[model samples]
Target: MPEYLVAIRSGRFDLAALKNLNTQRKDQISPLISVRGTSLQDFDNFVDDWGDRLFYLDISRQPKDLKEPRQQPDKPQKINILLERDLNNPKNAYENKRSFYSEQLEKNKNIVPVVSWRANDPIRDIARCAILLNKGGEQAIGVRIPIGKNGEPSNHSKEALSTILNSLPTPEKCVLIFDYQHISSFPSTDEDSWIFKTLSLAQNDYNIERAFLLSTSFPKERPDNGSSMITACLDWEWQATLRNSFEILGYGDYATSDPDGEMDFIPGMPTIPYAGYFSDSHLIWWTKKEGKDKEFSKYIGIAKEIVRLDYFHDDDFCWATIKYEEIASLGGGDKSGYGNNGVWLGFRINQHVAAMLNLANVNDSQIDEEIDLF
Candidate 1:
């Protein structure tokens, strides 16, 4: 039932090949707009002209005999496949997470970036990360709701989510990323069934278009089927049956020892950012929770060098990881990053806010941004 914009790569094969493919497909493909010798500019223009109506042709790069039915009669069964676990690569990580629910939330115009942190109790874990309601473009309204002693949503959180969703022109939108293991004790009903029940409530109550599960320890720690779940967090078991909730788990990016402690400047002096050794620093990857270490400060500090260019870099910009711990240590002598671990770094210096000038290098433009942490 799908039409296609069948691209005829004359440079590689003949036009008759596609006709053979159409024959095999029984003409399910239609209105094939042929393309050849088109430059990137021309292709863009053509795409703009076609807009949403244009569909892609699923052409195979493998050799085709074009003589008989594409499906071999002798080998009717598709080969057993083993999918690769390469989604953790920084370049493709965003895509891997986003594709999970692109179809369901196709109409919503904006997304609310959420970072759910693990906590000592149900209240603290829910209070771990911030809720960033996207304000049109590069700007966002950030809200960190403090959890009450009884683990209730603070007035601040209610106002933020309410005010944003009520005002938005969209019918459904919001990407709540729970960066922790679980919201253990929020509901007094039962221990094992709290997460699903709570999430089901959120789906019916709010305009949450989609949600990405960055991490959850329930399945791996308690696999009833005696199977490994941590290795594939996006499995069907972790998903809930909430009507409005389209949830997908992310690759284990934030599995770590420490969560919220800050790094101390040992002999500790902050350094300026530079160009060398940090050429690909525009994108930050935090698949683990160990970024407050001595080497972490050094590497990230160097990567945050100033670029005075007059444009934003969303195409290849920010990808921060929130986990079970803190971003930097705040205690006097603790570089261990667990000041009650809801200590998230997204509250501090994200890609939105460029690197601050190190007091050590106020006027040095080209020096290495190195630092020693306690």
Candidate 2:
């Protein structure tokens, strides 16, 4: 099992970040990648780039218009993929969906089916999937259960989970995930208590091999502050608190992007130039409104400000930091242009993953040094 889990949409920026991660960092993290409304060609491109790396592939949010790939590629090597889909799509017939899973399993020897227990989906349907996947020749499967809005499992979640688990042969082989979609604030004491209780039940009843608590607090829009803003890394703080209390649970978040998804960029719109830096516990942002400076110049200014911050790491820290320093050093006359929004996002996410990996492995004595390393 990976030490950290990151939930990200399967966009160009997100995929670029994952592709650029050093081999060491890649081994330590598993990305729950959501492929929503992506074309078949794009999906093939992702697989070709990723090669055989182990990652969770979620098509739960995929629309009906985007069809799954029918022609299987030549079997040079088995890909390590965890295939997942939600039963909430009323348009797709259950039998047809199951056939898709069967086809996927037949093509990729190492692919594991993930059974997601959504609150709105019927318990019987979830169980049927679990049973089918277990008998489909895979050694183990994944079970993802969503935490309710009240910051705890829904009242019937445990019972629903039990039904699904009973359908499988070995609970010990199951990978469990408790997903808390969008977090508005830090976890309260009561919320912590309930999470701990649910985790305990999962461990005691199933003796599962791995479990992760996933959520994100990244805002959908930048705050209306004047030139800059700072947001606490509440998701990290909450995960750290839980790890301190319970050592068994692993960590997961939506990377640096908002849980609702990335903001759409409008063409021909004069957007404010901004740069985001991820510190140990906060995301510091600097922005420049439209003014005398050109848009690219504004970005250069923002980059300069980011690199000068006290928490800023040197160029060797990661690819993003290197880019920050490079942008800061460019002369006004130089035509070397600052990258667009997707490019900047890729930089931020690359740095975020590296920083999260460092934090996850650091001890209490190393905390101070880790913060300074950011």
Best by TM-score: 2
Candidate 2, residue 246: Cα displacement in angstroms equals: 3.7
* Model 2 pairs whose backbones collide: none
Candidate 2 lands at a TM-score of 0.79
TM-score of each: 0.25, 0.79
Error of 1 at 164 (Å): 2.8
Give per-residue CA lDDT, model 1, range 346-374, as digits (tens): 21122212121111123334433232111
Candidate 1: residue 24 lDDT (0-100)? 24
Candidate 2 has an lDDT of 0.65
Candidate 2 positional error at 372, Å: 15
